[model samples]
Target: MSNPHKKEQHTGKDLPRWGMVIDLDRCVGCHTCEIACKMENDVPLGIWRSWVKEIEKGKYPNVVRSFRPTLCNHCENPACVKVCPVGAAWQREDGIVMVDPHLCVGCRYCMSACPYEVRYVHPQKGMIDKCDFCHTRVDAGLKPSCVEACPASARIFGNLNDPKSDVSKLVSTKSVTTLKPEMGTDPRVYYIGLDMATMEIKREAKLVWEK
Candidate 1:
């Protein structure tokens, strides 16, 4: 078998529109995907490009545990791309938002522009970094590290434009949701069985950058 991590060259033609569907029902909040993403991307200890949000619902006797796994939404109209003074942040034709480290001046403008608050400035590298849906792996015809590492198989990744794809089918049939839709970012990431907590932003919630 070929090495899946090795980069595969592609001609600039009709490329697939990449997207992800996360089944909140299947997510067990194990944090396995978090570790895999960190390892694959060499993320720092204090911050994370991807993380799980735990929501406790109902009273003790009838309580329920729900988890929301979050990362960059790779929006269709990314605020980060517009707010970047140096044009460091950009979106690809396939709808993946990427930050060019070479162009980045560590301005943190994108961090503020993102409503989801997923983007963060790397303390060590002095550059903006966030999940790009593991573009390197996707370009290599492999699933993202997080998706591959998911023990419960909660995450499904594929072309949303292809009707035959699992992601497309699920979106068409299931009542999925995107975060902060009012922001008009048109985020590509979708969720099934999303809880109320994940939809509401809490100012008291600890930030990833907060020490």
Candidate 2:
């Protein structure tokens, strides 16, 4: 199969169920993806639509470092979508969870409901803001900003339903995991080279803002 991970001419019909694969082995904790996402989305300094989480393991003598690029998981059963009192949070057919800024009343319910803690209330706009997988760019035949900017090529985005797509192949053929499976969100974002430590949900730090 062709390396569908790269931006190229796609020959097949556009598939449904957009998703992502992040290879932890390829990630270097550079935060380039974070900067790219912020620039592309115009996310303010105090908040992040996407962030790179640094995880360190082992004692000082055997120290190991890893990076996890986190965003809205865009779950198959989105908690945010269900909890939005005004229906501001909703999931598209393709699996992106979107917040309608105009309809949002800054209630922060969706923020609380999200297990990934990717959602944040925009202090200036009084609305919720989070990753939508750069849907506008994806619609324009482009990858998400973070995926495009990762120098290590650790991020892969494509339609999960297409068996021929790189993302689908990776998930099928490799060891993969989703964050907080116990939450039963069935998140579309899959991770390669992640350990149980990385998947452990930290409830004390609730929101991205708290981090």
Candidate 1: give the clashing pairs: none
Model 2 C-alpha lDDT per residue in residues 17-75, reported as the tens digit of each score = 88999999899889999999999999988889988888788998998887778888989
Per-residue lDDT of model 1, residues 4-53, tens digit only: 22233333446788999999989999999999999999999878989999
Overall local distance difference test of candidate 2 = 0.85
The candidate 2 region of ten consecutive residues with least summed lDDT is 2-11
TM-score of each: 0.89, 0.87
TM-score of 1: 0.89
Q: For each candidate, what is the lDDT?
A: 0.87, 0.85
Score residue 194 of candidate 2 by CA lDDT.
Answer: 81
